[model samples]
Target: MATTLAEFEAKVLLDQTLSTNHKSIIIPIELQEKEDSLPTNRFNKLFKLLIIYCLVLLVYPVYLGYAIYWHNINSINISWCEGLGFLLVVSTLVYTCLCYSFVLSPLVDHISFDIRFPGSMEKVIQSNEVRCAVSSIIILGCIIFLIIDTQDDRYRLVSAGGILLIILFGFAFSANRKKIVWRHVIWGIFLQIIFGILIMRWDSGRDFINCIGSKVDTFLGFTDSGSSFVFGYLVDQKPFLPTKLENGSLAKLVAEEINNSTAVKNIVVFKALSTVYFFSFLTSMLNYWGILQWFVQKIGWLLQTTIGTTACESLSASANIFLGQATTPFIIKPYLGQLTLSEIHAVMTGGFATIAGTVLAAYISLGVSSAHLLSASMMSAPAALAFAKLFYPEKETSRTKSDKISIKPPSEVNVLDAATQGASSAGLLVVNITAIVIAFIAFMSFINSLFEFFGDQVGIHNLTFDSILGKLFIPLSLSMGVEWNDCEKIAKLIGVKVVLNEFIAYRELGLLIQNEELSPRSAVIATYALCGFANPASIGIQLATLNSLAPQRQADFARVVFRAFISGNAACFLTACIAGTLYNEFTYVQL
Candidate 1:
């Protein structure tokens, strides 16, 4: 009544179609049957372990909630944003276990099922004209609302006009304006605009992004726990200023003195950048667990589909949000040689227009909003593609267009090995940031000194680098919708960022905010504008990384690299313009 294993194998060998089941899923049916025929004892052992692991995952969240409740009961201030994000991260781990729970059972035969979509629905889903129509309606609706709101207050129109100016500036520098793809450009702008509205104007979206940001801020703080033990008092200054001190006024004065000391500030700066170690470890672990790669592929796929970029360009662009410019190019290392000139430009511009998560803690330490940084990182993803296409339209056919590419997995032996390797690589970044800050500051000081001498000789008093840059970029600052009085001040920071680095610019911004020199709206606009890597140093960083990957194509893409530099700068400015548009003092503050 039953066939032997050899006979079943012979049948499968004779008929190739039998290798797959009706669902089109591969199933070596008889071989799986042979495996199932083994003793149940071995299978039960694994199933028991998996069930136990799943139980632990389910119970852990209860303890987490209890811990939060206990802390709150003791009057400890816990942000709802961080709490929500922590719970979401835990829930994700549990969901992962439930999905893999099928492994606890043996493979089964496929059952019959039917799924179909209506013809009209399928047609609508595939129609680009429909997409354009819907997008036009949404954009027009927003513009109309802004215009109506501006009837009572004319200032609302400034930011809307700024958005147009930024786009026009990109169009002015387009390398091949005739070949620009309007559909790709439209979708790109739509994504950025939608993201801006959701994150800045919508309540739920703001909370969601804040949750992610708060969780990240809390996670990176774990680095200080380790640093406190190794570095001693440098990280333990908080403990020295307890409220229980008998002489409260004297203790407050002493604490202020301690905090403001140059030594303390330098120590804080060092500790901030040292966070790269923990972040790298986290990144490596996530990659080992396939979490990082999974995110990269999904986001990459979305960008590739919507913006119509090649796989290499989209993946690297998404990767730049998490990974730094130095390593992001390696995601497409295998295809670097095959990328078109425009694809290469897109990838490089992306690296320019975003910062890495590893350095986010350092920026936040300089008093920037973590939520703004995270959203800017996401917003710049689409903006880079849009502006890059405008700057250098792709003239050649992409080899991997619309095709998904696999991420390169880590080569480390295990999770522990990943941790070791990750921490080891962080030293280079810490040193790089330190060297740049120290050496560049000293060099800039000398340059400013020379400028001051020449300025006094010419009857100008106190003229320096910022003054020169402030004068030079006043027009750009005005275009960002800043008040006329604040234009020169904001322009100076923009010039500093473009000429030097974002770190210096952000440091100055933090100081200005502390001194109450910049208004809230101007400070917010400056935050978005300065939140990119579009400095001169980045162009070289990208060129060196890309050249190492594909040396033969280096010469062809050299000039294109400079074009991407401009695109990257414009992309960041575009974001600043959007921020100016969406941020309403009366509405946002009231909300």
Candidate 2:
């Protein structure tokens, strides 16, 4: 054994000497041997190819069914060129996928397998070149199809093209183009379309969504019961109720109408803001019991699997659908320090892209469709991550060590303590919301007055801030499928939501719905577009809140605020696009 070991050491030393002397000759022979022994899984490769083929085959019939049904129902003439363009785009996508899976992937692996230092500049350049090539091919194919298909309806084509232009505009303004992953963008668009089809296009999907919405509405309606108990008739929409008299006689009791009554005091206080407190308290109890966390986790898993974001990012983003932006970071608070800048961007953007469940009751009270609101919140999860990545791509390596999330209960010893704390927190939110609304409304009114005075000199009698905003955002609104006549109106709401807050936008939207100012389809799109907290005010809130959680990352938080705001708006618009595309104006009746 000692002799053999000595012989092995001698041989190793001899080989080292030879390798140093003849580096080029020895390296080439070793590399050739390594290349010959490279691992290849034929079974796995064949199985994946087979699955792709099967999916394509299955989707073809569904596509045909939809096209045939739509054509028959609408009785619209289909041009041969349009049909050909659709086929060509579909074929090109499949061809690209096949080529990448079968050719490019293997070739790249064979060529670059021995390359070390994955983060080296050379590797990054090569990877970017390949990505750019693939993206260019796909984009070129889509552009060709768009040009071919647009030969018939120039107006519709222009609107569609405008939407595409908006997406490109976002990509063009990305902070880190090299870090932007195309897979996230592509999957994000696909997910939005799938959700739109499921919730807006199909009857079964609509039914499911409506049923869930009804439950949400019913749950929110329960808040009225508590409000009525404490605040009497002020919070009751139907204050009058039929009662049984003491003499075994039925009496129809009617409460006096409070709509125009100056005697009615504290109506808005009890009816609007109080409901937020009740819902928040209920949510707190659910969180303490682990119910809310369970649902958040399930949704987070879905996002993690689909978008490939970190567990912390996915959890916080998913939680935003149910909790307020200020409250959601607490779920992943411990891991905040470990999160990358992109992850932080995603968290903030996701928070801004969706409203809290506690406020859902307040919006529902405004007479918006509960189903649309719920769907919008749910869909914003993936949309937020997708757009955030596109705008501010993840450049830093993640430091998170765990995939599992364990949410600590709210800072309370008992369920009762949690409830009380939640109520107090909610009270602060109510005061802030109430004060902001009153102040902003008055501010906007003052601004409009100045605008109106200036417009009077210009001979435009009905000039206002909303009209100015409307003019600015009309192209974007029209691109989202709003009717030309209604584009300005919807644009005003969108502008208000971004410039001010979602509450003001929702208030205006409620008025639009009440007065029938917008078509049902347009209303649905606007509901989705205005469902987020992507206002200028949220930037301060996000910065303050997140900075407190991870003071070490204050610089990162500040850096991403503007990008996060843009990403949040893009997320809402993406959701709006899905809703607009799938929305059948004739079939949809406003609730």
Candidate 3:
């Protein structure tokens, strides 16, 4: 007989009463049979949902492929593929929402599955063994495929294999092998590969990403205009026309020379740093209008759905694309107290892996490609969660599992007030960035001077920090498919970024690009490698910022901050590896 809700509740009460009663009572065989069927029914329902979700995921990709084929056959632009992807994404989201609201919500309270099995150490050891064997087979297969496919210059393919091995070994050596989740690591690598292929290889993907990059450049150009209005000729780089003196006096020449010197000295301040304020203000106004929140939620939902991460980690990860690491924590402030250690690690790692949108303009000003930078920012979101999970798997259960993201608006006032507040907030950021640049640059110079002095005494007069770092990190750069000749140069940039910050590294990269010192492939790889906040200074910043927001988790933050820094570096390197593997030198054009 089928069980009713009333019968189920009555059975539950009877079981409780039987347990509490000191005297043993004989239970009816029919009731026991009914109870056994209840669990089976719940499991069947859950299994069905899982199967349906899997089918839904599978069908969308198939549909996307078919749509691309149809578009190509009809002589339509392949760009429609992106639209189809978006439509599928929306459909999946709506389906998920409906299922949760009408089906999962009620069933969740009635059914619970304990996925953790009983065997502990034996299971873990066996699991690790299987993981190592599978990973080795995959790596071996890839190397063999590369060797077989390339008729000429096969050594480069072998070198790529070696590089991949070294990166895997480096991360594995640093990670806690017992606690590391190899599945997450493998998935992370796969996702990075997929992202690189889509963004760099496929025509439709390239067009979509390029369109976004162009829009970003256009928006930044608008910000530049505002900066020019406020700072005059200082913010905008324009040719100066000298005034013709009526009498051709020496005083006129002196005045012109003074003006020229001032302009030259102020160029860095005006051209690079000043535009940040305007962009920040615009971003703040968008946040106030709910536009930024909507975008963040959609992106966060995607991450959560795919990566199986908590809402807080997912939201903060997505926010890092548009906001600074320091600013992203505020988006999920209410849920900070309830986040597990692993979730917090993901948050911090994501912050370090990607950069804020306000600074993209500054990097673009330094000659980095807008499309590459934007791609790195978007790809790092999933990569961050992947590495974070590998390094520190979630041990404690999360208190909240709702997919909905809660972002507190930055302002409740009018647009003018919002703009004013945004500008003010941006002013502080400008001062902070300026101070960091000056202090770090001066400090590195001092250290380099010491290195030079010691090296000169030892007959190595050309020795400097960059050269030292280059030598130390050449293997790492080479592993990213950088040419042997340019490995030192790329390595030096990576070292500088890790030791100092991405700003300094990007500045040096800009100089290298201007001098044509790096090949196009190498330049693209370096851009991805350096697109992060994974440096010594960021640890302190994260600690201070997150501690202020979630003071109770100070101990937790301190414990994972250093690991997060390492994970951040790994995340950027993963992106770089994918870029090096898929990116064609012929396709890259300086923007």
Return the top candidate by TM-score: 1
- Residue ranges of candidate 2 with Cα displaced over 4 Å: 1-163, 237-266, 401-405, 409-411, 457-460, 586-591
* Backbone clashes, candidate 2: 0
lDDT of each: 0.80, 0.79, 0.79
RMSD of 2: 18.4
**Per-model TM-score versus the true fold:** 0.80, 0.70, 0.72
Candidate 2 lDDT by residue in tens digits, 56-128:
7677657766876777798866642246344545566666766786789788978845755657776776686
- Compose the digit string of candidate 3's lDDT tens values, residues 219-279: 6777667667777767644334457554477867766766666544336667777668778
Per-residue alpha-carbon lDDT of candidate 1 for residues 1-591, written as tens digits (9 for 90 to 100) = 256888998888767765444335535666677688776767888899888877766576687778777877898765545554456566676667556545432333254446677999879876978877866886788788778756755764677787778778777877888888766666777788789889887888888787777777787788888877777666645435435566658877676567556245347444777688888878888878778877888788898888877778889889999987888988888888888889888988898888988887788767777888889889888888888888888899888754446776788899999887888888787888888778767877888999999999999989898789999998887887887878999999999899888888998998898888988788888888988888877777888888888899889669688888888888888888778777877666311
- In model 1, the clashing pairs are none
Give all candidate RMSDs, comma-separated: 11.1, 18.4, 16.1
Deviation of model 2 at 395, angstroms: 1.6
TM-score of 3: 0.72
Cα RMSD, model 3:
16.1
Candidate 3: list runs displaced more than 4 Å: 1-163, 237-266, 403-405, 409-411, 586-591
